[model samples]
Target: MPDRIEQAKRALRADLRERRQIVSSQTRDAAEAGIKEQLDALVDRLGARSISCFLSTPTEPGTHAFVTAAVARGIRVLLPITREDGLLDWSVATPETEIAEGLFGLPEPVGDVLGPIAVNDVDLLVIPAAAVDRHGMRLGWGRGYFDKTLGSMEKCPPVYAVIFDSEFVDDVPRDVHDQPVTGVVTPTRTIALASHHA
Candidate 1:
C-alpha cells in the first residue's frame, strides 16, 4: 500500500495531466515556440556546451524544435532512452538520429546507448514535469524514473523542468523521494528557485 502522500500526489498528477491533455493544437504550437525561445536564452545564459534534453510529445511543452536547433548550433544534445528498470539510458539526439517506439509509447533515440550516469557529462539538464511549485519541488508523472536519476547523481548539473506557465503552482506535495529542480522554464517565464535539493 502507498502512503497518504503518494496517494494525494497521484490524484494531483492525474488532474494536471488531464488539463494538459485538453490543450488545443494552436495553443500548444504557440506555447512550443515560446518555450523554444526561452530554452535558447537559457542555453546562452548557461553557456552549456552539452545538455540533456527530452523529445516532447505533441501535447507537452515542445522540446523537439529546441533540441534540433541546439544540435544545429553545435551543442551536444543528449536524450533519454528509457530502460526496463525505469532508469534512463542516454544517447546523442541528432536531427538524423532514428526515432523509434519506446517505453510508454513515447519516441526515443535509437542511437548508441550510454549508461545512466552519462548525464553527469552535460552542463545542463532539462526534464519534463507535470507541475512545479514555488519551492522548486516537482510533480512528475507518477513514475520514479527522473526522481531516481536525480537522486543518484553525485554532482548533478543545474536541472530545470520544462512546463507550461499555468502548471507552475504554489504548492506541490513532496516526500523524501521527491526531487527538487534548480528552476523551471515556462513558455513566457524562466523561474529560478533557491537551492533546496538537486
Candidate 2:
C-alpha cells in the first residue's frame, strides 16, 4: 500500500515538474514578484524576525527576491544546504552570500555551514513543495529532505510551503512519515490551512 502511494507521488511530481519547466519566463517573472509580496506580508503578519527558507530551483516558486529583500529589511534568513547524510545544513544569507549547486543540484547557499539544529531558532519556516492539499498535506519532490527536518524539530513554528496557485489541490498522497504544513504561500495569496499537526 505504501509503495502504491509512493508511486502515485512520483507520477504527480513528474507532471508538476514538467508543468513548472514549461512556464513562460514572463509568467515566471510575474509569479516571483507576487511571491515576494506575499512572503513579505506573511513575515509581517507572523512577526517572524528570523526564518528558514529554501533557495528555490528555477522550476519552483522563486524565493530569491524575498530572501534578498528580507536581509535588506534586517530579517535574519537561513538557507538550506543539503548534506550527504540526507539532512539539511543551514547558512545565514548575507547580501554577499553566493549560491552554488548542491549534491542534488539544488541551489544552496555558499557560506560557513551550520548544523541542522541551526533551524531550531527560526520563528517560521518556508519550504518548497510540488503541491499542497487544502488540509495542508504537502507533496514534496520525493527526496524527503523537508520531511526529515520537520520531523526532527522539537518545537516547530508555522511551516508554510511555497507553491504555484494551480498546485493547490484537493488532496495528495500522505505517507506516515509525511509532515503537514501550517499553510501554503502561493503567488496570489498566503492562506492558513487547518493542519492536524499545526
Candidate 3:
C-alpha cells in the first residue's frame, strides 16, 4: 500500500495539473488578492525586519502579490539560485538588481551572490509549493531543491507554504525526509499548525 505521503502527492499533482491547464484570469486575480491579504497580515504579525522570504515566480501560486507586499514593507527579500550539482543558494534582491535566466528558466539575481546564512537568521520562510495540508506538510515540484537545502540547515526557519486557497487540504502524504512547514498562507487566511515535533 502506498503510504499517506504518496497518496497525497498523487492527488496534489493531479489537482495542480488541472489547475495549471485552465487557470482563468479571473481566478488568478482572485488568488492574487487573497494572497496579498494574508501576506499583509503575516507581515504585520511578524514585523517586517523579522522576516526573510523567497521571491516567487509567475508560474507558481502567490508569486507577485507576496513579493510586492514584502518589498513595500521593506522586508528583506531573497531569491534562490540553482547552484552547481542542483544545490540552491539564496541572494538578496533589491530594486535596481537585474535578474538573468537561470536553471529551469528561473529568475536569479545578477549581483553578487550572498553566502549561505543560518536558517535561524530567517524568522519566516515563504516557500512555494504545489500543495499544502492543514498539518503543514508540503508537496514541492519533486526536484528536491527545498528538501535538500532545508534538510542541511542547522536550525530550520519557520517555513510557510504559499498556495492558492484551493491548494490547501486536510492531509498530504509525508515521508521521513519530507520537511513539514509551520504554517500555510493562502489567499483567504493563514493556517497555523501547532509545532508537531515540539
Candidate 4:
C-alpha cells in the first residue's frame, strides 16, 4: 500500500506541475475566484470560530481565499509550522503578521510560536492533500507531518481536505498512520459529511 501510494503521489505531482505550466494566468485567476466562492460558502456553513489552515505554497491547489475569508469573518486563523521531527505546530496569523521560511520551504508565522493547540480548540481545519478519496482518506506528499500532528490532538477538529476537482478519487491506499478528513472542498462544490472512518 505504501508503494502504491508513492507511485500515485509521483503521478499526481507530475500532473500538477505540467498542468500548472500550461495554465494561463487568466485561467488561474478565474479558478481562484471560483475556489473563493466555494470556500466562502463552506466556511459560512461550518461556522468555524478558531480555524487552523495552511498557507498556500505554489504547487498546492488552494487559493488562500479561505484564509482571507476566515480573517474577514473574525475567525481566529492559525498556520502550521513543520517541527524538527516533521510534526506540525500551529501559530496564529493576522493580516499584519510576518512569515518566514520553514521546512520544505513553506512560509510560517515569524512571531512567537504559540505551540500546538488542542484540536478541539479549532472548529475547522483546512487540510492540504495531494489527492483525496470519497471515503475521506487523504494522500499527502509522503511526509507524515499531518498524521503525527492530528494524532496528538486531544479532540479532532472538523477536517476538510482541499483539492482540485480532478484530484478527488474513488479510492486511495490507506495505512494506519494516514489521517482522514471529514469532508472535501473543490472549486466547484463541497462534498459534506464524508466519513474518513471507513
Per TM-score, the best of the predicted structures is 2
Looking at candidate 3, the ten consecutive residues that score lowest on lDDT are 114-123
* Model 1 weakest lDDT span, ten residues long: 189-198
Residue 133 CA displacement from its true place in model 4, Å: 0.9
List CA RMSD, all candidates: 1.4, 0.7, 2.7, 2.3
Taking all chains together, each candidate's TM-score versus the true structure is: 0.96, 0.98, 0.84, 0.87
Which prediction has the highest lDDT against the true structure?
2
lDDT of 2 by residue, 1-198 (tens): 999999999999999999999999888888899999999999999899999999988888889999999999999999999998989999999999999999999999999999999999999999999999998999999889999999999999999999999999999999999999999999999999998656
Q: Is candidate 1 or candidate 3 better by lDDT?
A: 1
For model 1, residues 1-198, the per-residue Cα lDDT tens digits are 348889989899889888989999998998889889999999999999999998898779998889989999999999998889989999998779988889998888998899998998999899999999999999998878899999989888889999999999999988888899999999898888975544
Candidate 3 off by > 4 Å: 1-11, 48-50, 118-120
Decreasing lDDT order of the candidates: 2, 1, 4, 3
Which stretches of candidate 1 lie above 4 Å from their native place? Answer: none
Error of 1 at 181 (Å): 0.3
Q: Write the per-residue lDDT of candidate 4 for residues 49-149, one digit (tens) a residue.
A: 78888886665565566677777779898888888877677777777778788887887777657666544488778878877887788877777788777
**Number of colliding residue pairs in each model:** 0, 0, 5, 0
Ranking of all predicted structures according to TM-score, beginning with the best and ending with the worst: 2, 1, 4, 3
Per-candidate local distance difference test:
0.90, 0.94, 0.71, 0.74
Cα miss at 172, model 3 (Å)? 1.7
